[model samples]
Target chain A: MEEVHGRHSSGWFDVCQHRRMSNTRSLPLLAPESDAAAGPCCPPLTERPFTAEEAETAARMFKALGDPVRLRLFSAVASHEGGEACVCDISDVGVSQPTVSHHLKKLKEAGLLTSERRGTWVYYRVEPSVLSAMGKLLTVAPAVL
Target chain B: MEEVHGRHSSGWFDVCQHRRMSNTRSLPLLAPESDAAAGPCCPPLTERPFTAEEAETAARMFKALGDPVRLRLFSAVASHEGGEACVCDISDVGVSQPTVSHHLKKLKEAGLLTSERRGTWVYYRVEPSVLSAMGKLLTVAPAVL
Candidate 1:
């Protein structure tokens, strides 16, 4: 059965999460336009609720990242060799075979990762737009004014 | 109790569940990256789990973004009028009041959001490094190459 979980792990999970968290926290303090290219447009969170469109968009991504197995798989793949990791590489990444595939599938649907087959291997790569958009969303911080 | 139940308003809940189901069948994918920066020092998830330094750093942020409430709150704040929202504005969003507070606190603790007292209103905005680093992390998709 599939259990609900969060996106980050500790130890190795720290790299991406660290990069992302520090990044997300920094922009609000530094400047405004840095993330404007990718982040959502609006004011502070405490100011109001997200609109339907915003909520849906963000929801889709979070839903994708919500799974612990998938999140770990993402970490494994990202940390894999050649910017891509084969399914063979992660068969033992602390989960069952089907679980790994299940996560890869969810991530693909989210458009955060894409795959291509090379012989017997299917490698995954991160979608820049998606990554940038995520970073952007995190950057939308308080307007000092 | 730490029950993060996503109880919907009956209709919305069903819709969410349905969407989740469809998403599962549609294409649960895994997003990976090939970073030009960071100089390729990490190992595979299967080969070795994430390091504590790595895990703690990453986990904090992922935990921040893991929840639906936090995601919505992040969006609402990011999309706010001036890029920051105050308590009054945030209180009006969906989810339970306590849930909202819980998420906001989490976000703040993760260093994504910061709060301040502006006369009568307590305002929240995105942190600086949090967004900046998030952007940088996206810019460079680290791969095993």
Candidate 2:
């Protein structure tokens, strides 16, 4: 997945490499690198109950996505071509530009997105693993499980 | 899926059949029966930007799950054996029974769980389609898409 973003030169990987140090706010909510490497952050909801700590972490991410405007903004960035979007390109969500920036910051703080400053514009990208991690969190295990 | 619940006899399907009329609160948030039949409620977030309406519906569901206590309770019932759990079996989440009941009601209102009263106890079941619908909402489109 890192190699797939080669077109961005070192910019994308630089963000990924520095994400942990700079984005400490995302540490509690984001799936750890180990979990991303292994699989979803935890087993499906149907497989077992979530511990209090697990519930807290997952709840933070869900809470960030619980707003309609934020959700729309997130979907816009997620669905944008090349799996990234410029704030200028995707900020038309019926709200003021500052509000959109606020929402994007919330999404980034929640670990659902990663952003970078490119020239004069800030570009947002959904971490490739986040969507699947969230999806898997709510997944119902197969009957055999 | 309907037939798979033969053990519950008519009780389960009775809830499903009457769900629309009785649980009108859930209607706005839940994916319609047609969406369930066809596939996920909408294209994955990465596949397309969500309409305001879509964002509203999805946000409602996510908001209901944004609380740690509610999420833990939901997980308890979801992970219970036989895909269902009696109220008495899952009310030990460090909260009062009434509080637990309140959380369960919110979950039901959000269309995450379905409840049926039998004798003195009410049983809750996670509608099989719901987990997958939610999972699909956050799924990333394959690179080919």
The residue pairs found clashing in candidate 2 are none
True contacts kept of 1: 0.29
What is the iRMS for every candidate structure? 6.5, 3.4
What TM-score against the true fold does each predicted structure earn?
0.53, 0.73
Write the residue-wise lDDT of candidate 1 on A37-56 in tens digits. 23444333333566655656
Measured by lDDT, the strongest candidate is 2
In order, the Cα lDDT scores of the candidates are 0.53, 0.71
Best-matching candidate per TM-score: 2
What is model 2's DockQ versus the real complex? Answer: 0.41
Model 1 bad stretches (over 4 Å): A1-50, A66-69, A79-82, A116-120, A139-145, B1-56, B66-68, B78-84, B116-121, B141-145
Task: Determine the C-alpha RMSD for candidate 1 after optimal superposition of all C-alphas.
Answer: 16.9
Top candidate when judged by DockQ against the true structure: 2
